[model samples]
Target: MGKMAAAVGSAATLAAEPGEDAFRKLFRFYRQSRPGTADLGGVIDFSAAHTARGAGPGAPKVVRSQLSVCSVSESDALRAGLQPVSTWRAYGLEGYPGFIFIPNPFLPGYQWHWVKQCLKFYPQKPNVCNLDKHMAREENQDVWEQSKALLRCKEVTKRRPRSLLEKLRWVTLGYHYNWDSKKYSADHYTPFPSDLAFLSEQVAAACGFQGFQAEAGILNYYRLDSTLGIHVDRSELDLSKPLLSFSFGQSAIFLLGGLRRDEAPTAMFMHSGDIMVMSGSSRLLNHAVPRVLPSAQEGNLPLCLGTPLPAALPRDTVVEPCSVEDQQLCASYLKTARVNMTVRQVVATDQDFPVEAAEESERDITKEGICHLEDKITHGKRVRLDPDS
Candidate 1:
């Protein structure tokens, strides 16, 4: 389809954990659909997005079933209900990169669990980092030295673009998406965490990417001035699946552009707790964050994320001190920083996506993974850098 078609009704099933199985039968919800029963009184949709899927020759059929509508009440206002789809405003020039969204999945109380999971599983420092095989650099000793110094600094700040040592601070979950080599390979990988995999599926399901398995993730740490160089992600064997992204702490100026680096990217603000989905034609477009905005910009949104979250340390038997330390480090640092967690599918189907070609190709051009997804984000030429002193 040239433009992504919006499905009228949403479908979802909620199942509690095994410990709560006994209560499932007692409170079964038998939601039924009847025509012309949409309640418009309690809700307001002021978005520029036209009423999707109206009736005509090629019009969509009226579905009086379960529906979720997330429209902008104002440039900064947000409204969310039971649905777990994307709700923040979207911007794009051509309709080629289709954006389908749902209501905000971010909840103030419980949704913090996702943030906690990120700190628990991912590493902020490169020494113990399991991603990208930074340990394999036979000659780049600077990567190790710069990374060590980057972690030692307690205050959050982005260094000049002349050096990309800050990127070495991120952690990758799932399949360990590799940027230097440009593909996912078993030769270097970290098994995708089960909790994060399930979370990715939940976020994807609401946005029409059902059965989506999260094969890769790049948990990017953005200091107040950090800027991700523009890039594209074609490493994944499958582009059909939607990419899931979550923003925590400070906001960011996300850029979405055409297929090449020459295309001037459109900028948008991504608030913490906000979710972004990129599917259909938009899957392979060029995108990047030129800078991490200060927390002062929280006035426009983040009404749900009231007052900064306090430092939390969740216990895990396997990785106790590690998880706790990460939590404390992130919690203290995030007071002036942001953490962008993006999930993407790497290998398409069960087929062998041999990384033989990706490793040999010397092409330094930037490609993308998906919406707001920084899969294998590298410092490409598009980004403006400060001249070295």
Candidate 2:
């Protein structure tokens, strides 16, 4: 028997109670910190799918997906830092009908551009981030500029306090998401980045989802131990639209569950430059990141991250090389972190949020005299972690 099958069979031996959530038990099993407690044998690694054919986790039957090679032009694909459509390798699991996974389809050195953008550009003003809860507007602006020096020198001053960039937990672009309300409102909106929108549209077109609009985005920054809770992304007004997720820096274990929260989930590894699209029936599936692989736990960065870019690129290329200073900052931050950007369409073309209903909901909350609380309640006392943590 394969290790994945054996590990999963052992988990089933626990004989969960009638009402117990099987998914949570497995999540906790993988999240365990004690040495020899967590078993990674069951985690699927698509990078090795070619060689580990029948031996990997779940031995998932990987099938090649037909891409609309004609949907995108050669010039356009190159500008987006993507290889020719005919050369791209897209896959779909046997049971996952509408699910698609493209393992690192990016051209050599192209992933760095996106990584730099995530670290330096996206967290700036006009974009909403976790740190905005208590920080002043001026103070929160220019996160990259303020934290660059500290992060660049992080290696030398190993004991220095954490930088603002390190403190960033999440960032929302375009139509910002409300964590407490678990909804997106018309009033709470911002212009999505054009570069990201173009990239999303190109990938969608290649995957047979023509004219997909890039509307809302949620960028999650994770450390080695930080975990995202199990949740379904059904807040979007339009359930018909597909969701695009892009991963960079380090590797992570992604748990994809079924419609019911109690259902046991399938685990997979999401490495840098990997792209996943959950569409059709899989659009609203429950998913979470149980753990981020400790690539930097012992101070080693993944070899894929060190790829060098060519000397020059086409003038029309959407992505280009970043400055040496900025590159240094990104390298320093990525040493112990992972960044994931999920771009999704919130509303259809003819669809507009019911402003009256949202206003009424707010009025009702005010009438009840209930105050919204922030997720972090330090009460003026700060929580600190080791410099590496």
lDDT of 2: 0.73
Candidate 2, residues 115-161, lDDT tens digits: the string is 88888889988887777765877997999888876886756343676
Scored by TM-score, the top model is 2
**RMSD to truth, every model:** 16.4, 5.1
Across residues 1-389, which tens digit of lDDT does each residue of candidate 1 receive?
A: 21112111111111222343211211121112111232111111212244233221222222212212232222112122112333333322234445443324443433344555554435533212323333443333344334433444655333523123344346566554544455554544567776667656665654556578887787776655455655565667787877777777766656555665444333345666666677778777766665555554432224444433334423321112224444444444455567777788866666665767445333321231222222223444222221000
Score candidate 1 by TM-score against the native: 0.56
The alpha-carbon deviation from the true structure for residue 29 of candidate 2, after best TM-score superposition, in angstroms, is 1.2
My TM-score estimates for the predictions, one after another, are 0.56, 0.87
Each model's C-alpha lDDT? Answer: 0.46, 0.73
Best candidate per lDDT, number? 2
Q: Judge candidate 1 against the unseen true structure and give its global Cα lDDT, from 0 to 1.
A: 0.46
lDDT for 369 in candidate 2 is: 17
Q: Which stretches of candidate 2 lie over 4 Å from their true place?
A: 1-8, 12-19, 33-38, 51-60, 156-158, 356-389
